[model samples]
Target: MRILMATAAVTALTLAACSPAANDQKSGEPAPPNPTQTVAAPAEKPVYRFKIGALDAIALFDGQNPVPNDNKVFGVGLTPQAVAAPLTAAGQPADPIMLEIHPLLVRNGDRTMLFDAGLGAGKGQLMQSLQTAGVDPANITDVMISHGHPDHVGGLVADGAPAFPNAAIRMSEAEWASIRANPEMADLVRVITPKVQAFRPDEEVAPGVEAQDTAGHTPGHVAYLITDGQNQLLYTGDLMHHWVLSVEHPDWTVGYDDDATAGKKARLDEITALRASGAHIYAYHFPFPGLGKIQTREGRATFISEAQPAA
Candidate 1:
């Protein structure tokens, strides 16, 4: 019996040695080669340029923050499923929602203005984007803020000093007051106090640019309107973040809103007005280069992204 077993083992080994390897499945085709080593490329810098009426506007991409996909962070009274439905239907991920941060650069004649500073210092790409757009930080004549939130004002200071030494910082009076009352932003206020040019709600901060009160995201959250007689564009700061959830379901409260009820009302009113007028919109947290027009059908507002200009 031992001799027979040894013979059988020897025969099996001989047959296996003559057979093809596992990877050589095809009868005549050569075995697939090993995968080549790969190196990941650096992220592309997102900078979009377009016209806002006659004014040249460049969308400077700051970056995106991932937020928890929970009812507590989004729709306070609704379930996570309900909040994610719109995003899912739009082929977007439902969890860990990505919130984009964009600041606008507008140039009319020799005047240059930056809408919001973005995540300041080392946290964002505003500086790189400006360089790519052939803009100098020192040459920025005006820095128009929608609100005094960290992302908006954080870039105002670097090493406890003004980041844009030559630019005059402007915001609404209410926003300035709100920032002063918040102890957490004391450092920021101290550095920017001298340059702060607080304006009335509807005051014009620059030529062809007017601030519109759109409170609720913050007490003094405002939107800017840029018009050049024949054309117009609205820069909706934080009135809405995700285009679909914010525009389609304006009643849903976001976790970041200071007053959810007021936020909802402001979003509804602003979106409705924009939709009615067919004005171009630049949403800070929509998609990159968030230049688009809102379309309402069957009581639902849909964001239609504008096509990028040809290279």
Candidate 2:
């Protein structure tokens, strides 16, 4: 449990939205060729849907990754046993913890916007999630990137081409620079460079979507604040990952943070801001369709998922 192990761990986070997603699979294994296995994915159930004034907001389910309760990713400065105690108390599995990756789709007038594309089309479930939501990639006029992490950017391109051909890839200038400078992400940069539209951290890339600089997790890490009339929802992108470990003990940093101290502070600040705003939040790495509100129970903030029945 090293307190600051950002350098090596940050490298692993580069190609992942969450480390578990990238670490879980063997690259060479192909999908089984059975006919039924290849059966076309249908327009499945809506992940989670609600409204933001005139805007139609939907949480698209990309996928989930379960990782062991190791001190590497989460709880960067504590033993696994220390982390497991919280899980066991919460009645959650104490061994492997689950992390979900879900993209958000918002419809404002003729403009269709997506907040961070998930792990590409075939590689993850972003496409199926989109299909189920009745949205076509071409209809997405804006792809608002929270940061340049692999999982968020992966679905931006597919098969060596821009996944959302008609969409403008928007991100903070600092974030774009970080991605562009990475030699390992050369291919990805090449594909999206032309479509990339770098803006200031707090710029309003779209009408109701204002990018709030929640830096720390990444240089230009941001959370989207979508406001329409009185309705609002915050798209929290990796500001915190685990629903419990993160919200309960945000002081416990994640190794993936490029700046661990700042990341922890960002979590505290976000929790305070969210509580003050009283706006719904979409946590990218919480449970699927992570739409929820923060409820301060007993003294600490806890997530109350509106998408889940028992919350």
Instruction: Give Cα-based local distance difference scores for all models.
Output: 0.76, 0.74
lDDT of 2 by residue, 1-311 (tens): 11111123222233332223332225463321110000011124435667878789887877666778888887877899999987665545556776767888899988899999988867678888788778888889999999988779989988899999999999998899888888988999999999999988776878888998988999889899899998888898999798778877888878889999999899988887776655688889875566766755445566655542211
User: What are the clashing pairs of model 2?
Assistant: 120-155
Quality of model 2 by C-alpha lDDT:
0.74
For candidate 1, what is the TM-score? Answer: 0.84
Error of 1 at 98 (Å): 1.4
In model 1, the runs with Cα more than 4 Å from the true position are 1-42
Candidate 1 residue-wise lDDT at 175 = 92
Tally clashes: model 2.
1
lDDT of 2 at 292: 65
lDDT of 1 by residue, 1-311 (tens): 11221233223333222233421234564322211110111025457778876778888877676678888767888998998987776545577776778899999887899999999978987888888788889998899999988888888898899989998999999999999999999999899999989898787778989999999999999999998988888999998888668877887888888988888899989888877876888889876666766765444576655524324
